[model samples]
Target: MENANRGYERLFGDDGLTVGATFPLTSARTTRPNVGRELALTERLEALGFDGLWARDVPTDWPKFDDTGQTFDPWTWLSRVAARTDDVALGTASVVLTLRHPLHVAKQAASLDHLSEGRLVLGVASGDRPPEYEAFGVAEDERGAAFRESVEVLRAAWRDAHPEVETRWGTLDGTLDVVPKPTAGDLPLLVTGNSRQSREWIAAHGDGWLFYHLPEDALRSYLDDWNERTAAPFVTTCTVDLAGDPEADPEHVNQGFRAGAAWFRDYFRELDAWGVDHVIVGVRGDDRERAYERVAERVLDRL
Candidate 1:
């Protein structure tokens, strides 16, 4: 696949590793964060040496799930981030394709890609939230198929003029076309999670893979499995709570780690050596700016 998008280039490459950050960049245990403050922090992303910024698509607040995923619409929030920064790739950790119309996603993603000058890399997924399925009138069991359809639609809508497509979301005849095609002609679609699809299916379809954090041994195994299927890039999410002590040993936290800079440096190196292309860092600290600086100085620069 042709990766002409700047964001795709910034995030994925050969024999290299880069780091990005996710929203709710601070340790605010709330559904929402201060938008102005967050925007200000975004302006400094590239200056801080971060390569990308990620947003999550949380259609609604599911208290049981307990994560608001930045508590803003992913498209709107990313536009704001795009306006404030230059160069850093803007991404969705994974948009819930099952809940959205693929044509709409295609238009919005293409528009953002242009507005940001080809700095959009969409990570798409079949949603996992059960209640959201009911709310959106989407069948939970059929999300896998819907996800595949959405991916197909998005690619067609972007690459072809007035492309013909037939799916559960209705048909797009060769009459009207979605305008403002991605600057790269096609955007990079990184499949998130299994998305209720077979590993072979994901490998064949996705331009890349967005996976969650795993233990070193497990990650190496997963990478090996992925390499056997395809040579596409692999990205993972890592949530870290940086300690005050530089040499502090890592203590596993929820889905991530509470560790110091020293531990993270070693961990990132291992990931790089394992052929992991990028990591979307979710900082779990009160002072996100300080934590970002620490990682930049102690981990990223050294790498």
Candidate 2:
């Protein structure tokens, strides 16, 4: 927490609300989206003064799940996003830590952090797909322990030189080290969901918490509890399908709501007042460019 990097500051350095958008802005229904259009939209968002651009980690496509989250590997996709935009915080909505090797994750993350000039903010999760876990040869039940160990290993690799470490993944002796430490000497890691760990544990170990969209009253209660537990920032994602009418009422959608610009402006105002640090907004309508512009003009600017 001492060496909080540029990305962290971009998103949570201040004590108010900042807005970001999730990828696949070009297409929401399919796993693969038009990459060129996505990048173009990304640059536009940054130019419009959005604080962050987040990438999702969907290593393998699951048919039952409706959304695949940009379809590209988070690291490589984020690297591309980093190259396209300057100053926008680049983040992983989360990397599936339980399915990957911690050392590899450490190297990839550090490398990305440096290449992005310290703009990488990592949101890591213990994956939920049972079949994917089987495919990766990781035990489903052990993911919680794996998730905890991964966190410890990541911290050790970034903070210490050739730090001796042992966990379910492997053992690292003092002889070897993960090269290219993060640009600011450390990366801000926000634990996604609970990741099968206790809230107390996450509050103690993580730089922040990344949560899914919740109803207003539920979110307020959760935020109050989080405030009581720790001072770490809280980040949440909300999908939006902006209605054509400016004064439309909010209708519940998957993980978010469908509403008009007027309603969203008031909603974000409430979130800011409730102490939510950042909101990663996912626009869901067909005309994403229009949705982006509307959010910036009507929702973000109003706040």
Candidate 3:
């Protein structure tokens, strides 16, 4: 963990599971906002003892995707979040690296990390939305290579004063530099999913892995595979819509479960047992406020 960020260490500590929040902190999936409410919720989440505050990168309003992802440019959004919060780890649940230039990403990520006082956790991925790829004029088929190249550039820019990297994206010939290095000197790069790269490649390049939700057995199997590949941390997103009953059993809901606090606590314990280092819990429901309170009371407090 050389050059590790303190906030990151708080969020994903050495040997235990931690929980974090994803914005806009409500169940809404569209592009409109109660910006003030969201910010207030962020402060409240940190006070409630959440380890991290995560933002997503969705460059456009792709109708098919449905999820608008907090509907803000991540750099601006995260810098703003950084100012308003004191202790929570600031993260991109992931920024799509394929659509963006590496130099721009490096500069912006470093800036945010500095602004947040080393709280930034850079979650990155290749472009996933087909329409987004078309709009960026990048070939979807070439994204795998593009993603790999971008990772190299981001790392080089942060780790070296004048990074000279030669890739199809372009060369950083050491003539110029991406300034404002992260407080840790180099920020952690948590690769989101395979990103069209092999598991081995992720193991070699990424500091950690952020995966989508899968069943317990499936996630365990995947973690088993990752254990063979590398010793990096394993992270996953869980969209929770907590039930009213403490003893309610789990029912399926959009890559997560609709379970009561009793079941939810037990389920998280199960995930922890399965080597899931952290979970990005996206609570979804009409009564998100109630869910939030209940989460801290019955679920998080007990955990």
Candidate 4:
């Protein structure tokens, strides 16, 4: 918990409200690797006073789902973003820990955290895609245990003097330290969704929570459940397609809200009232410039 505190302090500071925007990995209809454009967008968001930038982890191909994420590796993109930007915290909405070896994740996360000068927040999950699990040679039913053990391994690897971690996934010799040490000496690990883990486990382990889109009433219920179980704050990411028109009708996307600036203000206000610490907005749809400007002018001011 001390390490968790260090990680939390580096990212959240004292505001208790860190507004951020999700990095757009894929264009509307293109598969072109656009880290440059995404970096430009991130710079714009940073100048516009957003607190952090969140990346998504989509490692495998799953066409039927039509993933909005575009399936780019999160850590690679974040490393690029970290080098490009100075102030904004670099983060992943949720890295699929179950599919990856913990040592690799720990090393990469620690390196990014060090490179970014303590601005990395790692959100991890068990993952839901059966195909992804199959591709990774991981059984669907075993992901829960895999996820738990992975977290344990990562933590053990990053400890003050590193400890031996032996699990079904792998084994670590005594005290195998993962470098570079985090700027705050520990990487913040936020859990996404339930990740097939119990509330008590989450409450005791996770530094924070990453939840997806939910209605206000439902969000309130979910947050209440989480808060009651764990006193730590929760962070949620949702997509938004801001319109030029102030009276734009609300459109729905997967785990996102598409509306005008006015609507966004109201939505964020509701989230603030609910004690949500951070909201990462994924801006999609047309007129990216107008959306960014509108959010900067109307939405960022309120946050």
Each candidate structure's count of clashing pairs: 0, 0, 0, 0
Clashing pairs in model 1, backbone N/Cα/C closer than 3 A? none
Per-residue C-alpha lDDT of model 2 across residues 1-303, encoded as one tens digit per residue: 777888999999887799998887787777579888888998899988899988888888888876677888888898888888889999998999998898999999999998899899999999877789999999899999999999999999998999899998889889898998888887888999999999999999999999999988889998999989999999998987788898999999988989998898888888988989999988876778888888898888877
Stretches of candidate 3 exceeding 4 Å from the true structure: none
Q: Best-fitting candidate, measured by lDDT? A: 2
Expressed as tens digits, the lDDT of each residue in 123-179 for candidate 4 is 899987878887889999989999999999888877756568789867777746667
> What is the C-alpha lDDT profile of model 3 across 10-37, one tens digit per residue?
7666687898878888646757667788
Cα error of candidate 3 at position 219, Å: 0.4
Q: TM-scores across all candidates?
A: 0.97, 0.97, 0.97, 0.91
Stretches of candidate 4 off by over 4 Å are 1-11, 25-29, 68-71, 243-253
The global Cα lDDT (0 to 1) of model 1 is 0.88
Better of 3 and 4 by lDDT: 3
Q: Each candidate's root-mean-square deviation in Å?
A: 1.3, 1.1, 1.2, 2.3
Q: For model 4, state the Cα shift of residue 272 in Å.
A: 0.7
Off by over 4 Å in 2: none
lDDT of 3: 0.86
Better of 1 and 2 by TM-score: 2
